[model samples]
Target: MSLGRRSVVTLAAAVLLLGGCGGGGQEAGAGAGAKVTVEWWNIVTTEPLKSIWAEKVKEYQALHPGVVIKNVPIENEAYKARLTTLNQSGKTPDIFTTWGGGVLKQQVDAGLAKDVSDEVAPWIGTMTPASLQAYQFDGRTYAVPADIGMVGFWYNKALFAKAGITAPPTTWSGLLDDVGKLKAAGVTPIALAGKEKWPGHYYWAYLAMRIAGLDALEQAAADHEFGGPGFVEAGRRLKELVDLAPFQKGFLGASYNTPDGQAATMGNGKAAMELMGQWAPVVQKEAGKDLGDDLGFFPFPAVDGGKGLVTDAFGGGGGYAVGQDAPAEAVDFLKFLSQAGNHREAVASGAVLPVVKGAEDAVKDPNLAVVARTLASATGFQLYLDQAYPPAVGQEVNDSVAELIAGRKTPEQVAQAITATAKSE
Candidate 1:
């Protein structure tokens, strides 16, 4: 999620497209007059999107010569909190980063975001439908997706070989066995940033998705319930991993990219694997030693008797939506950002997964390309649990799962905790 994130209570849908928000009421290049500045809010503060985005903004302004794009970059947690505050007043930047789900729906409900359908009609056919799913609701589009990807196991092949594990696991039992082997070989089996909660939640969420399937999770949300047997089973499976004591020391307090945290741990070759999305390798290199050719990726293994297929993917991507009062130029800038050539540059720079139909050829990273192709063939897709559910329920899921991983909560207790939160919401 170079442009998106794992945080919650932000995205939403729209039932009716808004008027005057059809996009492109102004000329492509503005005439000499007062400078029209587009207040752009986004979370591309990390590389390679950070640097690539800055250069692209400069080029767009240079091409227009009369538009000023003010970019307000924020971190993951901070971005969520800030947007939440602004959303209270029904205000957002002209072009803001959106994960494009219930948050976008809420924004549309509040009349705070523009309907981008009319503006994107011509070029919409050039992008993949799956990549565009999160941005659309009730037959209307609100956001332009920049990156699309799914989460899976990113491992160190060298470490796996050292552990005598010849291949990645294909079943839940095999995964546990592999973890034990890695530990016996003096390696931390998994790199987890427990303080962050989101990374750890991946385990239980993926387990739930595996045991319960995507449709079950959606149904649970619709009914505000998580005490289902599948959820308890998911937690019990995660507990088995936790019982092995596989994560790095101090994992409970670990940060995602800090020097001693998750990405760095794996990137530095101290851990065998991590369950992460397409950004893993990029952040691995950014935060620690580059794994180079030793890096490998595999889909999360199927449970022995699970409902989800190995073909089902779990993750989301980044997109941009306009404010309801945003100038048509704002929508124009979005178009500029998503043009096939521009998106190709982002792909080549290793900042994003391919979103446009033909941009997959632009991918330069082998690991990311694996993820791209995996997504291309996925039979089902699940946005991150946090981004998929209401904010409180999502956070509760994270917190309760963390407690379970720490041996502070039982599997039944965790499911009940999440159910309690969900029902209250």
Candidate 2:
């Protein structure tokens, strides 16, 4: 789902490499006067994380004189390629950013990630389980969860009024009716960056979760079969909205961060809403005119007879994992970084959505706070499928779902195509 960030990751031709605390040193000390270096690779190139992370590292290092923390903030796409190369070369950073889905699973499967289950157990209960969902596999944990968030509809309240939608719908049927009303009022009902197939896949993914339950998704991935009735039904529901032609003009090929893309369409009030993650408002403000107080948010509506609860959430967040060969100091540094007090400082930057329990109060943004609270109490949570499955299988889901959205495939066909890919993987 790009975590539904509108698929803005920039793929680079080459990876950025930086020299870290190395040179066959005995160790970068972590204990006072005991030098031990922890090479940490992360992708917080953007603020407030970029600045906030550096400050936290400094604080951690100050507390442990001999501990030198090397922070490397890499770009997203570059990180992926570079990490793949590192995995193939059988080397890993002491601590590195991870999403804890297919990629991390592969890394873990290949024995590249450290088993932090025991390390995290003592304080694990202090954090919300939903925030740690992606990092756990077969009752074992492999990473330290940092931030957690979900995806839903972000809409313009004024536009809703203009279209006579007194309130956001709470059911799938009501939502479809609202879409029809918006279209009847001649307003572009929705904004979608179809060029980024990940955005299109969210519709199918969420619907599947609502109808089949989160377990169904995990089961499908395990069984390498998406031919279940719930999978087909999810495609059908998505097709219902697509058939209504609810999206913006030329949305089929619209780029997300471009001047005239999905975020801009909603930000500029040319469209009523967009199905996106917590970062929706940020992108809206950046790419188009700010909607400010006029904007509102709501979870995806519940489907009738669905196995999933309305409180179920579908999303994931950026996290960090210890490498198989990283210095023990790396895990300690991560623990320091995730402390309630230290993590709360990041809330002020308005870039991160906190994962640590008791830090929700640090969130001052109204819309984001709503999301945070909802996630805190969510009855179930599912990480984005693309991030939760093998890379090949994940891409197949996106491609197949997009083809379904573009009117080029049927629900059954979509399910079959994805199943085929999963089996191949």
Candidate 3:
């Protein structure tokens, strides 16, 4: 499970290829020298991305003195609701955040998104191709990615040692055993934001990926069915963990970035680990004490005899897409943000995983570097289920999985619920 130098070198090679954007007709400050306002929306209410993004806005405005970039930072779930509402109302912010999968596809289909293929072509070649995969459609680009990463277990090394565990687990059964050992050592084995629903879905999603294989999930989605035996087994496996009572007390009511929530629980050492994405460490530090050297990361363990390999990755990153009605400055601003110098600031802040060529060096956090390496060596990649599937179907997966975790639904029922929803969609 150790991410070796080979993987790191692989990642370095992937990001070292040669390319900038916003060059043709209008510059970022164009418009008869009159002041232009660009409303940029993103889910960055938390630091260090929040502050770093704000500084970038200021810097952009400073350089393009005639442009006023309005930065709107929203909380995670709230941002989803707000954006959904806007989309339903036939409106969108000038520039907004996107996960760049089914949701982005829907927007493009509805004519709510802009195609930036030509605008970004000059520099898109410089980015990691995998990072751009989610944002591209019909051989055209729809968004500019600023971050890229995967979801995995962020664990406490000290807590693992206290539980007499010498190495991270590589198999599902080993992970369960380690959970038990941690609990026996009087530690809350895992911190989960059950109330958030999405975080809870990661467990089920990763389990499904590990058990059913990546191709199976994709086929299931395409077939509008999720009630296959493999998916049911994935739920049963999650149920096995849930039955162990591994999460922190009141986990069902916990938020993600709040003071008493998942990241905080893991950050304060109230729990040994959390299944989250690359942002986990940053939020943990912001919401609670910095674990510093005690922090460690490991990929999700593989299920024994499963079709999936241990190297398959499950996650996605944040990207920016311009609205159809947005002014050209919106695209220009995205180009400006995509510049290595500006983006390196976010990467250096440990808030972004490198997407730009030569930007990998900006990743200073060891755990994040491990993520980058592991991602590079992945045998397959699946975007987060909630993003990979249509909005309704993805929400159904989250809701059904949450019910399964809450002990209100059987493994079979969880699969059935998801399948039913997918079919209706």
RMSD of each: 5.0, 3.0, 8.6
Cα error, residue 66 of model 2, in Å, equals: 1.9
Clashing pairs in 2: 1-4, 28-35, 28-36, 28-37, 29-34, 29-35, 29-36, 29-66, 29-67
lDDT per residue for candidate 2 within 85-169, as digits (tens), equals 5666666788888888777787888888889988877877777878888888999999988888899999999989998999999
Model 1: residue 373 alpha-carbon error in angstroms: 1.6
Q: Candidate 3: global Cα-lDDT?
A: 0.82
Residue 227 displacement in candidate 1 (angstroms): 1.7
Model 2's lDDT to the true fold?
A: 0.83
TM-score of candidate 1 versus the correct structure, residues matched by position: 0.86
Better of 2 and 3 by lDDT: 2
Which residue runs of candidate 3 sit more than 4 Å off their true CA positions?
Answer: 1-89, 325-332, 376-379
Worst 10 residues of 3 by lDDT: 3-12
lDDT of 1 by residue, 1-425 (tens): 46666645444333223232122233447565667778788888877778888988998999998777887788877777667667665577788788876677778888988888998898888877768877887799998888888888999999999999999998999999999999888988999999998888888989998999988998998898888988999999999999999999999999999998899999999999999988888789988999999999999999978898878888889888888777767878888888888889988987788888877778877878888888767787787778777677878988999999889999999999988988887
Order of the predicted models by TM-score, top scorer first: 2, 1, 3
- RMSD in angstroms, candidate 3? 8.6
The candidate maximizing TM-score is 2
lDDT of 3 at 363: 78
